[model samples]
Target: MDPIAPESADEVFLTAEEYEAVHAAVRTVAGSRGAGQPQTLNSLFEQWDELVHEVEEGYGWSAPELSNDLGCRTALAHVWRLLPPRVRAIRQPELDEIDRRFHATTVGWPGRDDQEGQWWLRRVPRHLEAETSQRSTHGWPMGWDVMAFPKPEAVEIAD
Candidate 1:
């Protein structure tokens, strides 16, 4: 058997059409499920049809002749889910990267004050160790206790 040569980047860079097509195929494959309550691999070929459409639509994809890359593997990631008694799967190192970069990016506390295009997020301090409110005592302060100290010099009694 002969060894296959690798695909050059010139052959596979993404185009707008390719983007749309691959997007559509991946979307379809992602959504496909079998008739079984749990579903199985029957939809994989259906998913492959999707992949073929994407390739034919020219998102810079040529049909796989001998070898492939993450793109094909990603398509099959969905396909793998559909396989009956499926054991094989592709592991994506970049799934971590994609999760890090893009997953749940829209999640966060919404601004408490959204006025005049300003979004102010409000958070209360969780716990303060040495916090206490001043007592509302109505009387003596610093001078009150000082009054107890002897008058510096009693004003000499007036004659």
Candidate 2:
């Protein structure tokens, strides 16, 4: 499906409530392991997976289930793009760390032969790029505007 962009530069894709929910979720996961210990790749992947599930449940956008890791990863990529810049700015460091670690450790994209790395680390960026291109060419995801900011009820006009 084609991606949808906001109608104008000033337009908002997600409401403040939605942004807060996602930001809170990121904070909870980022802090789940405590301060001193470094996060393992598995833990990072699991945390991101949980975020993806939360987004799917919260927004009622069914991309795929947890059983399909690749699908969930792809959905997360789209969700990542949907987040407001501020939220992404806060999390970019951690995300970059994940990418760096994954690159240092893994040979290539996770597959039947190389399943050691987090699929998201390698695949998500590609998805993000594709989403951006689609958004530029097409627009934001279908129904996102309505979902994010629903129109108010119409009143009857008197003659």
Candidate 3:
């Protein structure tokens, strides 16, 4: 890999369609997951490297290859930045409900109150027993908590 050449005023770049094909190829390889082969974001970049080589060999005359590894990495980083949220939209109300439920049994009073303290302690055993019994029968995810939820991208507001 060579250092990135500084863009000259007269240099022409490849068409958008050519680069987009490379990006699409990366997505195609990433999505074709196989048994015992869990893919991560790094795997996408690795696939992109291979695609870049193929593209360079196949279409070098018309579509100039990206300069180097840095170019390939930067191109994919740009693609990722432009991507919309990949996770499902999480509602504000649902997040609020999770927050409420998480804190519901806590004794907020500054001073110790026997009844306030005891109420939560009493609920713990019942909640645990129910969670244990329901887990296997209903296939409820064990230790399902707000922290376990995948964070979704926030809506971008235009000023």
Per-residue lDDT of 64 in model 2: 35
Score residue 107 of candidate 3 by CA lDDT: 21
- Residue 139 Cα positional deviation in candidate 2, in Å, after optimal superposition: 45
Segments in model 1 whose C-alpha atoms lie over 4 Å from true places: 1-38, 60-159
lDDT of 3: 0.31
Provide the lDDT at 119 for model 2: 48
Candidate 3 shows a clash count of 0
Off by over 4 Å in 2: 1-67, 70-72, 109-159
lDDT of 2 by residue, 22-97 (tens): 6444344444355765333234455654554443333222123322434334444545665557656655665665
Best by lDDT: 2
lDDT string, candidate 1, 66-148, tens digits: 02322343445554444322122211332333323221221212333423221111111111112123211421122112222
- Ordered list by lDDT, greatest first: 2, 3, 1
lDDT of 3 by residue, 70-140 (tens): 23334444445433332111122332342244234222222334354222221111012122332322232
Q: Which residue pairs in candidate 3 have backbone atoms (N, alpha carbon, C) closer than 3 angstroms, thus clashing? A: none
Residue 153, candidate 3: Cα error in Å is 43
lDDT minimum window of 10 residues, candidate 2: 150-159
Please list the residue runs of candidate 3 whose C-alpha ends up more than 4 Å from where it truly belongs after superposition. Answer: 1-32, 59-159
